[model samples]
Target: MAAFTATCCGRALKMVVFLARLVFQLLAVYAVVLLLVYVCQRSLQYFPDKNHPGDPKESAAPSMREVELRTEDGLTLNAWFAAPVKRDGKIVVMYHGNAGHIGHRAVKAQHFIDKGMGVLLVEYRGFGGNIGSPSEQGLYKDGRAALSFLEKQEYANAQLVIYGESIGSGVATQMAYEIQPRYLILEAPFSSAAAVAKKRYFFLPVDWLMKDRFDNIDKIGGIKTNLLIVHGDEDSVIPIELAQMLYEQANHPKEFITINGGHHNDLYDHHAGHVVTEWLEKQIAAEEPAVKPEE
Candidate 1:
């Protein structure tokens, strides 16, 4: 009977050991996965060349002139300036989404030009074959540099309109907070990069793991400039809810426009340019002093 009891105890001890080994193996695999995610997190966040053609020259329009901007951090950034056919003394400094170079946004520039507003399509450091890598701070520097270049051109602060698309919204928010442009527009903006990352990578601890926390929500409250947020109700990338949340947090003189049946990349197809141009005209009219009847 004692031998039987001893054998049973030995079997229980072996089972416990086996369970322990299994747990350790599982943990090791999980740790390796975490390591891999950490190493490649930035790559997932930024896609500078996504859908880009082989030649950067293809992105330029006939009226688009190449401009060189020098960032405060000593990076030479490339930009395309599409002057308005009829100058309205207003310029839109466009900060494009994460993917692709300025060429991807040339059409948007054309839209601005057609509206009699010039466009300064600033390319981030790592984008558009520019020098230096991209990071949250690096993008901010790039934004400031673009603004500085514009300032040197003697455009009044009231004539400068800041426009951000997708991830560029974060950069634009930071700039608007600091520089306080006459008008600020964000297209399909997220609340924060961390929030989006958490949703997309629900299984992982993305809040702690994300490096580029473009916390636009925290900064939007400080932007006192006139704001316009254009979002697609059917956007799957940066959901419309995020844009709504941002609009709610923004100060007065803010407008939120939702395009029906518009997805993430096709808001332009849904008359986004018309909406923007109309809003811009309203703002410009508001700035003009009331015309008094001639005596």
Candidate 2:
């Protein structure tokens, strides 16, 4: 009876150890899956806005001129250079958020133009009517391509501003670090994509699992341009605190606009284009022009 009792205890101990090992293995696999999901989502950001038929048309007239551009990677990008009715020299290279083509930005573009700022709305490769797939690198390529398109036009009298919304913030931040624009405007921007992922998956070890940094906090400091960050106080999609964090990470000559009753989607619900355009104009007025090299 004693030997039998000892044997039973040994078997139970072995079973417990085996189960613990199995649990550890499952956890390891789960961590890997989370990482993979982060990578896939980051990769998909490149081609975010796939063309969809029956999308709502813009309220603006057909005043904007359509332009085609090609990135160095052989991806074609579509752009609309909406010239103001008065053809002002100021140009805004605007980047729409993660999930919409340039067409969806007609209201924003019109607002900029109405403020005497020409708007160059770019379509990332694989988004909208553009060709090729989107990756983080691909979006950066498209941004450079958009800058190149505008530079070739010698819009010398116009000041260049970059406006990036949501996911476009990463792309715009990257560009702003590389080139000196008049101002860098980020709407609903996150400090980093990794940080945002961690928030969404609090239980998961997302920091270790994420592959794409999209580290705006690191990039914002290198930008010398005036910075404007806009976020709603009650933004649910991206918490208002993240916007404040982004602002804190930035350097001097930065401003934050707290939109009252502004949810992420309804920032301009009441003011429509009037408020944004006016804010942009104020930003432009406050900025000192970039110093160009001697001719």
Q: Judged by lDDT, which candidate is best? A: 1
TM-score of 2: 0.84
Tens digits of per-residue lDDT for model 1 on 1-59?
99999999999999999999999999999899999889988778898863323233455
Look at candidate 1 and give me any clashing residue pairs.
none
**What is the model-wide C-alpha lDDT for candidate 1?**
0.86
lDDT of each: 0.86, 0.76
Residue-level lDDT of model 2, residues 1-295, one tens digit each, is 9999999999999999999999999999987877677667666334366763123234352467778777887766667776544444678888777776877777777777766667888888778866777667878899999888877776642367888888788888998898877788888888987787667778777667665668888888888887888887877767888878889988888888888788876676756356666767777666648788998
Clashes of each: 0, 1
> Over all chains combined, what TM-score does candidate 1 have?
0.92
Error of 2 at 212 (Å): 2.9
Badly placed stretches (over 4 Å) of model 2 are 1-4, 28-39, 43-47, 52-61, 85-88, 270-272, 286-295
> Which model scores highest in TM-score?
1
